[model samples]
Target chain A: MSNVIEVKNLTKSYKEIKALNDLSFEVTEGEILGLLGPNGSGKSTTINCILSLLKYDEGSITVFGKDMKPDSYDIKAKLGVVFQDVAVFDELTVYENIDYFCGLYIKDKATRKKYVEEAIDLVSLSEFKKFYPKKLSGGLLRRLNIACGIAHKPKLIFLDEPTVAVDPQSRNSILEGIMKLRDMGATIVYTTHYMEEVEMICDRVIIIDKGHVLASGTTDELKRLAKIDEKIIVEANSFDSKYIEEIKSFKAVHSADYKERVLTVSYKEGADNLVKIIEYLKKNHIKYSRVYSERPTLNDVFLELTGKELRD
Target chain B: MFVHNFKYSLKALFRNKTLIFWTLMFPIILGTFFKMAFSNVTSSEAFKAINFAVVEDDNFKNDEVFVTVIKELSDEDGDNRIFDTTYVENEDEAKELLVDGKIDGYLVMPDKKDDTPGVTFINNGINQTIIKNVVEEIALNEKIGNEIGETIVKDEMAKGNFNIDIDGIYEKVMEKMSDETNLLDKSANKLDYSMIEFYTLIAMTCIYGGMLSIASINNSLANISQKGKRVSVAPTRKLVTVLSSLLASYVIQLVGLALLFVYTIFALNIDYGDNIAKVILLGAVGSLAGLAMGLFVGTVFKAGENAKTGILIAITMFFCNFAGMFGITMKYITDTKMPWLTKINPVGLITDGLYALYYYNTTDRFSADIINLIILTLVLTAVSFFSIRRRRYDSI
Candidate 1:
């Protein structure tokens, strides 16, 4: 697929501090590219620079093979951006807000109306169409914000932390809607600190830290970058400290940690690691309430790369 | 795009309760209060004829011109009477009237031919001032009349016409002095001191249009509001958006001004003079200046909306006070003492324009005020445009 956006050697600074340091990335057409990073790690800055909403200190950005500029009306007409902050007008109703923003790009009344209604339906905000922003709940307001941003139905959409501070149901709905947008032949650039969200909807992921791109790949490929293949957790009321040392002695066990009545062991390369731990627990007469094993997650990859959790 | 933005901008500005209160309700309420405060002041404080006694001594009786002037001024049946003169037989009786407070002052004839007439009063006041002014004017006119009579007699003798008519020369001198010394020219428009308050109120109302423009402009600048950020990202040109929003604000401001005019003219029965069209024109230009001020405050300052609003209020009230909204005396003081302040102030310009329209026979002053207001509006708009046209910012 051709690239919808390209940024080479991108750099941005806030006085003495750099916000984006040699940040480089490409968003392929018709795919969801996740920009995963902690707070203040240049995720929003990168998106702003790409959309020409900000002036970077160095490097260049191009959208649809043309240089992005503040007056690039043609490129801007075909692009949609949902900023991290809710940007809908409080004085307008949900429907009016959507219609107003959509009218910015779509001049036809009939088409704008149809698109506004479709957007409301996509974000499940049809029931609250007549409600003002001040009357809507936080999650519903977020949905309205999304609907307003995407009502124009642009070929490329930028969703910057669209699901921040939302309930599970709203987050799920937002993720599903983004997936639908990707399925409808639009290139999507999604930014969030939620690793699970990146894992769920992102076709390709780029992990960023302190304004640097640490790693980039599919979810599974990124996960492989972790030092461990499998992780096991055992919950018990009582556990001897010696068992952690014993677990670490296992050939496949990369490390073991025990705290707060739970013992976790990570395997470097192993199958049936949970079974092995369960058999060992039984032979040692150690009573465990539950034992489980799972594949390494993107958080593990981030921790391996930056020595910190993705949320930190 | 302009229409779309304009339509929504109107809706947004109209729905803003804060903007509505400051731009419409606040000025109207303040005007109502001003009306109530100044309703009866003009009538109660109007000028009344002063009372005084004149001693009919030998010198007073011998001066026919002075006696005739006093009789004409003290004629109760005359329309131009300025004094309630009480004739006394001697100086003792006039002094008794002055001491008893029955008269503001008494006019005493000179005992010697070379001495001037004198006035006596128990207290200094408007009535005493009027009496003193009248006595001094009569003395000066007598001196001028004597001088003219001598000049005419000498000129006639030089022409060899020795039968000089002294009475005719005195009559001509009196006529000429009367014609030349009439300094007060009553205008066709009545002197309404209360109208100054109303004019300043109108000026206040016009400058209050700044609030509406500030709110509208705030919604158009990317660094000021979230909605502005959304607008900045749109494909439409920034000029169209800014101009359309300002036009909507201007229309609303004009409507508010029109309502004020209707209220003050019809309901309160206040007369805004005969030049209603010029008054409206001044209000329109003044409102434009107000909008320009708002645009300047909104874009030039990096402060928040509330801070900018505080600054606008400070500016509007400052100009209004200087324009005599608080009191007519302030307007006079500013106009006489600090005319440059009034020249630069939008509210002062509007108030002075309205004052000129109501009080003057010509439109020269009013036209100059209008021109100054338009120039001020253009300058503010140019500066604000320069500030607002910047598409990129160092920070949001």
Candidate 2:
């Protein structure tokens, strides 16, 4: 698929702080590209610059083969953005809010009504269509905010932490709905701090930190970038520390430890690494209750790429 | 898109309880307080006939013309009657009645040749002072007429004209003086000065339109509100959103002004002005100016929302008070001491425009005020528009 959005050498600064530095990326069509980062990792700033809602110091952004600008209505008409903060008129009802926002791009009343109804159903807000924003719960308000942003059926959609502060139920529903949107042939750029969300739906993920792209690829591809290939855990009683030291001497074994009747080992790269560990436990006469092996996850890759520092 | 934006803005603003309260209900309530406070003031109601005590001494009984004039003034059946007078037997009796507050003051007959029928009063309050001035004016005119009649009669005698009617000449002179003065026991409409308060109240109501302008600014700028950011990112142009919201606010403010005008005239029975069309036109223009002033303040001050609101209110009250909303002579003071202020201040121009329309016979002054008010409205609107039009924030 051809790239729908091409951002090259995007740089933005606020006073003395650099928000985005020499950031370059492209989003392919018909794919969910997750822009994953911790809080204050320039995810929102990058999305804003891409949407032309903000000005960048040195960069060029192209959407649908055209340069994006403040007056780029043609490009903006086919774009939808759901900001991190819920943004809907408090005075308007759910249906009216959706309809009013949808009317901005789709002027035809008949078409707008059809689209508004579809959007309401998409977000499952039919029961609360007549409710004001203040009357709705946090989850419902977030849903309503999403409905307002996507009611116009824009081809390119940018969702900035749409599921923040939402309950698990609403988060699942929102994730499912986003997948459905991508299935309907809309290119989406979803930004979030949660690693599970990126692994769940994103076809390709970009892990960013400090205004720089640390790693970008499929979830499995990102996981492959980790130093450890797999983690092996054995719940054994009285496991010998001598065996732990022996396991650490193996070429494939990155590290091994025995604590609290559990023997755990990390491997660098070995398809039979788990089998070898289990054989060793049996040979050493270690009584094991449960034995399990797990593959490296996106969280490990994220932590390895971006240090574990507290960000506000 | 503009129409759509305008429609939603109207729906949203109309439902705002705070906006409605400040724009409509607050003015009506304040107007009620004004009516209750000024209910008994003399200028608030029609002028009533003054009560007087005339001493009936020997000098008073000898003056037939004075007695006829007093009788005519004391008669209740004639429109020429103004004084409710009672005849007392002596100066002590008149003085006793004046001290007892039974009458405004007592009229003493001229005891000396050049006294000119002098009068005295117990207190110089509005009612007592008005009665004293009226009695003294009548007595002085009668004296002058008598002196003129005597002079003319002496000239006639010197020419050997003995057929001249002395009483007729004196009566003719007095009648001419009464006709010219137009204050001789004649019931005429008094100019109500209390209307100035009501005009200032209206000026205040228009200035309260700052609330709408504040709303407009909050709605248009992205830094202040989330709705602003949402609209700014939409496919529609930013200017369209600003203009549409402003138009909606202008329409609501104009309606608010009309309701206040009608309420003051019909419900409160306040005399606004004779020309209804001119008043409405001036009110519309004044409301526009007020709206512009609010917009300018809201745009110029990038402070917090509450701080901006307080600033708008403080500025508006400052202008209204200077225009004499609290004191009637404040406008006069501003006009005299700071004459240039009345010409430039929007509230000053609004109240002065209404004042001119109320009192001045020619539309020249009223037209000038309206023109100045329109120019002020345009200038404020332009300044605020240009100041806020292409504002691209460094950060939102």
Candidate 3:
């Protein structure tokens, strides 16, 4: 696939703190590239640098094969950005707001009307078209914000934590709308703190921390990097620490812990690992209600690569 | 792109109740207050014939010139009249009227050889002054014309032409007494000092254009507002957006100014000038200058939104106060003591332009003030644009 955005050696500093340090990444066309990072990890700064909204100390950013600059309207015309904040006019109705923003990119009246209506439908804000932003609920307001950004139907879009503080339903609808946008042949660069959102909607993910990208790959590929072959959970009426210790001695077991009425065993790598754990439990007569086995999720990969350190 | 930006900007600003209130409705409300407060003042200051009582005594009957002068001065006809004269039966009645404040003053005819007929007043004031001046001028005319008539009569008698009708001669003298000069020249001067208050109010209203320009700048620059970020990232050039938004501001301000002008000129009954077009032109330029000043403030300062708005209002009102919104003489003091401030101050410039239109006979001063305001507008607009040109925020 062709690359829509490329960044090389991006560095940004603010007074005494470094925001982005030699960060590099590329977003290929026709895919949702999730930029996953904890708070204050240069995700917003990176997106701002790529959008030419901020000047970096050292960087080269190109969008659609052109060096991105503040005056790069040609490149910006095909780009849409939905900031993390709910940026919209409170005085304008939903339709008027969408029309005003859509008019920014599409000048033709008829085409703009069609696109505005389509966007209103895409976000499912048809009923609230005539309502002012202040009168709408939080979820409806968020949908209106999205409609404003994507109404022009730009080829590349940047959604900076679009689902932050949103309810589950709205977040799901937003994710579905974003997927629909991608299916319509647009490249999306999504940023969020939610790891599941990245795993659910992102075709590829970049895990970053401390102004550095620790790893980047598809969800399954990134999970493999965690090196956790299986996670086995056993629900039991009673669990003994001796049993946990015994499970920990197994050659395939990486770690074992028992909490409440359940016991969990993480295996490093082994085929039939679940079977071995089940046979051992049956032989020890460790009564269990349910047992399940699963592979490591994308969050496990994130925690493994970025380290489970608290960031401010 | 410009049209789209301008249209949306107009819509947004119109919907902004705060802007609408301050720009359009507040000025009208203040004007109503000014009208109510100044109406009585104008009425009290209007020129009306003074009232006086004359003592009808033997000395007064002998003084034919005084009698005729009073007759002509207090005639029933509105024209060529200065006093509403009443002849009293005695000095007690005249004094009673004077003390009772029914008449402004009383006139007494000369009774003794050393006595001269003169005016008396209850107190020294504008009405008393008017009555005193008119009575004094009549006394002087009688004295001068009496001497001239005596000389003419003696010369005619010496030439043995004594059948010249001396009474007719005296009447002619009275007729030609004050014909060479008029007491009050009301032909050329049209300035009513009370109207300066309204002009200053209009001047203050014009400066309210700052609100619109500040809104424009705030809505177009990324660091100023969230809407600014969207505007910055739009496909349209930033310059186009800024200028179009400014044009929208100018239109809205001009409309507000026009409303103020119409209200003050017609509804409030204040005379701005006879040249309506020129007055409107000066006001338009003043609004532009005011808008530019606000844009300059918005672009040059990175203050918060409310802070910037407060600064704009405070600064404009400061200049307006100096331009005499509070007192008419303040403008004169500022003009004389700190003439450069008057030249540089936008509100002062607009107030002076309107003042010149009202008081000055020629358009020279008005044109100069207009030019200065236009230059100020251009300079401020240039500085504002220079400050905002391709500006990229370190963070937003």
Candidate 4:
């Protein structure tokens, strides 16, 4: 498969902070690559380096086999950028905004008109075409940002946290849009802090932290790499930390956490772990309100790989 | 791509309210100010204010002629206005008053030297040339009128045509000549009044153009503020962007100048002059100078709206002040010898061009005005070129 983007030994720094350290990545045509990282984990830095928006100390970045610069019109002509901040001309209405963005790419008025309408339809913004960006809700504005970015139907796209601060409904629609773009054969590199989004749509995921790639694979594959198998949580009025540790002595229980008058027991590759936890709770005479048992998820994988402590 | 960029500039020009106001309305307001201040100069009143002050000296042979001429020149009902008059003590006092804003000009006469009498006039005025004309005409009238009055008195004494009362005959002839003097001043001043206005209008136009240039370039540079971010991703080079943007603003400025001309010439019937072409040329040159100045400011510093607009106003005001916008700024200006700075100054050049075209004939100096415009345009272009080149959009 032909790779749509290629970055080799991409290293970038700002003063003393190393934003990207010898990063290497590629996205094949028609594939969706999710770049998952916590906040300030060099995700944006990587994307910016790839886009040539920021100069890098040491690296080579190519899109469609050509170098990029401010005057790289040939490559930039096919480029589409949708900043997370929702950038659109305030003076222009929704339709004009899309038309103007599209106009930048496609000058033919009729062709631009068709593409703008298609973009509006793609974002489900037909009803709000006449409204200004300020008049639209956050969801509609986000959609408008998407429409403006993708109206020219670029072959390669970098959707940087497109669903940040969006409502659940808008999130679903954005996810659906990503899927539709992927099906339409655009190679997309999506970065987001939301691991659930990575699992939902990404064909492949690379998780990075502190300017270094930690783990990269499919969701299930990543889950397998993490040692913890299943996590069990029990909300109780009061639980002794020592009793939770005693539950950890169970052969299947890999680890246990007790805090805020509740107990969470993580088991290693086991099915009857929740039942065992409940019995242990009852025998201990701990009054529990509710219980949940779930297999290892991408979020669990994320925390396990990047430590459970809060990052600055 | 260039065409779209041009269209984008047009869209920006039309839609951006602040840009529109600065480019179009600002100049109109400025022009209205010029029109109000210069309204008197353009009307019939320009003739009446063309006065000369005569200082009475001790060694004068014709003291009676000086006082009688003054009295005759003054219209009885109309403040005895004869191109307006002022009587002062001596040359120093007359000129001091003229300089001190008490009179337009003062005429000095040396004691009658057999055939070589000297008259010196100091001008404190709007129409110095007109004041000079009044002084010269009065001097000529008194010299020849006195000669003829004395001749007629002697003829009446020798011919015995009447009772030979020499003083009475002199008075009658003087009265007759005084009536003629009044007629001559009235006709001459009325006929030549527009010349003064023509020069004033040219100066005012230059002021307007200079000020508007600053505003136009400022607004043009400001137009690029938002697009500064887009430059990184845009297809066109920064050179193209700046050039195209400046060119677009140049067009808007031309429109502003046209509006001024229309308001003055067509709407208000203020005759700009016979040389309409020169006026147009001056407007174009002045606008270019303003545009270049704006570019200089834009490229000099990373400016916001207030500072950007401020620099524009300041530069235009600076240049316009030198352009003699009100005839007051350059009143005491004694640098007429080196007309290069005044002539090479874009405002000065345009004002000079307009003045020549309106009042005088199309001389070589008018053509040299083109050279002045060329130099100014080149200077501004170099400044703008360097500015745009040095203007880095790194991480902006």
**Highest lDDT scorer:** 1
Candidate 4 per-residue lDDT over residues B106-192, each given as its tens digit: 666655533433434354334564454344455555666677777887787688776677777777877767654542333433344
Writing each residue's lDDT as its tens digit, candidate 1 over B1-396 gives: 999999988987888888888888887888888778776665567645678899988889988767987887776676556778999999899989988889989988897755788888877544664566467656666766677778888999999999989788878887776664431222212445567778878887787888888888888877788788888888989888889999999999999999889988888888887789999999999999999999999889888888998999999889888887776667756765698998899999998899777655356678999999999999999999988777877767
Using lDDT as the yardstick, the better of models 1 and 2 is 1
Model 2, span A1-312: residue lDDT tens: 998999898889998999898999999999999998888889988887876767789989999989988788898899988988998877789999999889889999999999999999999999999998999999999999999999999899999999999999999989988998999999999998888999999999998887889999999999989999888989977776777789899878887888888877888885888788778877877788999998888998898888877778
TM-score of 3: 0.75
Candidate 1 runs further than 4 Å off: A238-252, A258-261, A283-287, A307-312, B40-190
Sort by DockQ, top down from the best: 1, 3, 2, 4
Better of 3 and 4 by DockQ: 3
Clashing pairs in 3: none
Which predicted model would earn the best TM-score?
Answer: 1
Highest DockQ: give the candidate number.
1
- Kindly list the per-residue Cα lDDT of model 2 for residues B99-122, writing each as its tens digit: 888888777777674576656576
Candidate 1's DockQ is: 0.55
Error of 2 at A224 (Å): 1.7
Q: What is the lDDT of residue B393 in candidate 3?
A: 69
**How many residue pairs clash in all the candidates, one count each?**
0, 0, 0, 4
Clashing pairs in 2: none
Q: DockQ numbers for every candidate? A: 0.55, 0.37, 0.45, 0.17
